[model samples]
Target: MATMITDECINCGACEPECPNTAIYQGGVEYDGLDGAKHAALSNDFFYIVPEKCTECVGFFDHEACAAVCPVDCCVPDPNIPESEEVLMTRARQLHPEQAFPEDYPSRFKAGAAAPAASAAPAAAAAPAAPVAAAPAGGATFVQSPLDALADTVPALESWDVPLTCFRCRGEFEVPFQFIKPGTVLHCPHCAGSFVPNTILYRDVAKRVTKFYDSFTAGLDAIRSRHQAEIERFEDQLRQSLQKLKDDVKEASADAALAGAPQKNRGFFG
Candidate 1:
């Protein structure tokens, strides 16, 4: 089933950026599919997801990103638009031609369960028994929130876990998204090393994200250039047509004036 936003949504819009298919839109706003098709807003009072564009994150992630990130738990499956895993995956392929999905691509359907959005890597799923209260030393740039004061009383790395690889150590770990952002360094649970930007993981992510942006801008520029050329061509055609009409009117007026004027008996035939 395609995911749907329930009316319980608070419109915090936390789920918008998390959607891989760009299916979610703000209340009363129109949405453009990845294929450039426009879809009307499903709801004017609450954020909505376009069912046609939603693949339930079948080929992109193990779980639905939008549902996982929704603060109000409003993102839920829509029984009205039920779809099989194969069908969802086919739509995913159509939406993202640049991404490759192997036969063994991750899918919540394959797992038979929708896992947490930011869970640990499959191999380290059970390694978070030791609770950490503060952000680790080294590459970590965890922004302190008001909640930090309660870290000592609360569990560590226990919420909003985001799976990330440590670039320097090549180690994998789960960190909370609340603490990290671009340039915020994170430590690998295995190596305890700080992250650097020169690793293969970083390069791969950078290349994919860069390609997405580059392709988007290039497409827009091509459309803009084509529209500009077409507009100019039509303007030139209309200008020629207007000039011809003006010239015709002027010639007609001159002929009418000559015919209406009395002619002198200079010619014997007149």
Candidate 2:
């Protein structure tokens, strides 16, 4: 019965400080332990929720604290990760050993109030997530956070899953990206192109496109240089052959002139 934040988080840092368990963190920040240490191995690309400390306000208040304060209504129950109220109550006791549930009840508590019933209502009304194959046959179907679900519906990005390539360098590659609303510019290491994720797949496509163009241009330059060198060699050989022919012609003319010297003083026929 842990509470979670959806991708709808505006990163306003509003709901972060309000968590009694300090489970909420800014996008890309690390959440280590109850002591609030950073676990560097975990990525900080987006806001994260720590499951260890979340108690769903079982003992603290009648309702979830984060859901109450969240402006975007992104704080909702995680259906994929379901837990019963008994489990939440036990966890609350572990966290605050001295606290007790219904300690101040004056015996006039409602016979069957619906706080527990309403909590399940939101999850019931929400669309069920696509079941993962690895999950147990009857296990809870893990769905993406609310933000992820919304991103999947956004159009104009259907082909984003296609590989990316760089127009300038012809470099091709795949890149990992997290969806950010209004899509932000991405930097590719291969083609060095800056692009936006129009769809979920755009980031990878852009990376691959950059890589493809880079390789293509390099290959083209190599072929051109090789052909240029061959042409220069052929031209050099032709120049050498022409020079030899000119020398031979000059020798033949000299021999002819020497051989006809005896008739030089003769008439026009000589």
Candidate 3:
């Protein structure tokens, strides 16, 4: 289980920079994974998270880093998905174990295990599914939406929770967004736009962006490789031509020398 962002996010660009795992991203941007294998497109409607890379601050902070600084208190615990403190710590260690921890740093969970269940009060399970894949190095780049007053985008999260839906295609999907701010547009993976009123259509936008991003990147690589190969071939041809010219000049010089060689006189005409 991991943390999620709700639709209340104001797109202030505050939480985007504070994320530790670089899991947070702007709605429309794409991120490359640390594995150097895949890329993920972000939604344009609201701030998003990458679940695969989110350790929920288990390894580093006693509490969540993003939640600490979010002015709106939107970075609350995700109720739907829950994990023990131990599990969160393990996840954190796995994400960034290279850092050194203080000798007396306290762990929130049981000794070498996940935190105990909180008296069986219907524990939270897992974090919402992220929209994009993890990147190779610095992960995703979050682009905060320009602030403009629009109709409130958030719902009464304290009451009924809303599900992520494709605005255009009417498809039900999973995209982790918290209700931190307003006027934050959620991006559609297929339709190439944000879902106004949060519907199924925007999923199409998201999908299309992903496809285009991948194809465009692949095409760029292909073109670059072809150009390099062509340049190399041309250089090789030029070298060969230069060598041929040199050989021809040498041959002509040799021929001239032979032709100019004075005929040997029968006797010794000095």
* Candidate No. with top lDDT: 1
Model 1 alpha-carbon drift over 4 Å, by segment? 33-37, 112-270
**Every candidate's lDDT:** 0.67, 0.55, 0.54
The top-ranked prediction according to TM-score is: 1
Per-residue alpha-carbon lDDT of model 1 for 29-106, expressed as tens digits? 988966677767779999999998999998888889887765445677886888998999999998889988888887
Model 2 poorest ten-residue lDDT run: 123-132
Model 2 ranges with Cα > 4 A deviation? 34-43, 98-270
The sequence of per-residue lDDT tens digits that candidate 3 reaches over residues 1-270 is 566666555555666666778888887778656575557565678777766666666665555666554433345556677767567666656667796656544443426633321222221222322223233467557443221111123222222233565757876654433331244566666665675442343344444333433333333333445557788999999999999999999998876747568866788657
Better of 1 and 3 by TM-score: 1
RMSD of 3: 19.9
**Candidate 1 at 9: error in angstroms?**
0.3
Give the 10-residue window scoring lowest on summed lDDT in candidate 3.
147-156
What is the clash count of model 1?
Answer: 2
Instruction: For each candidate in turn, give its C-alpha RMSD to the true structure in angstroms.
Output: 19.7, 32.5, 19.9
TM-score of 2: 0.37
Candidate 1 local Cα displacement, residue 216, angstroms? 36
Better of 1 and 3 by lDDT: 1
Give lDDT: candidate 3, residue 150: 16
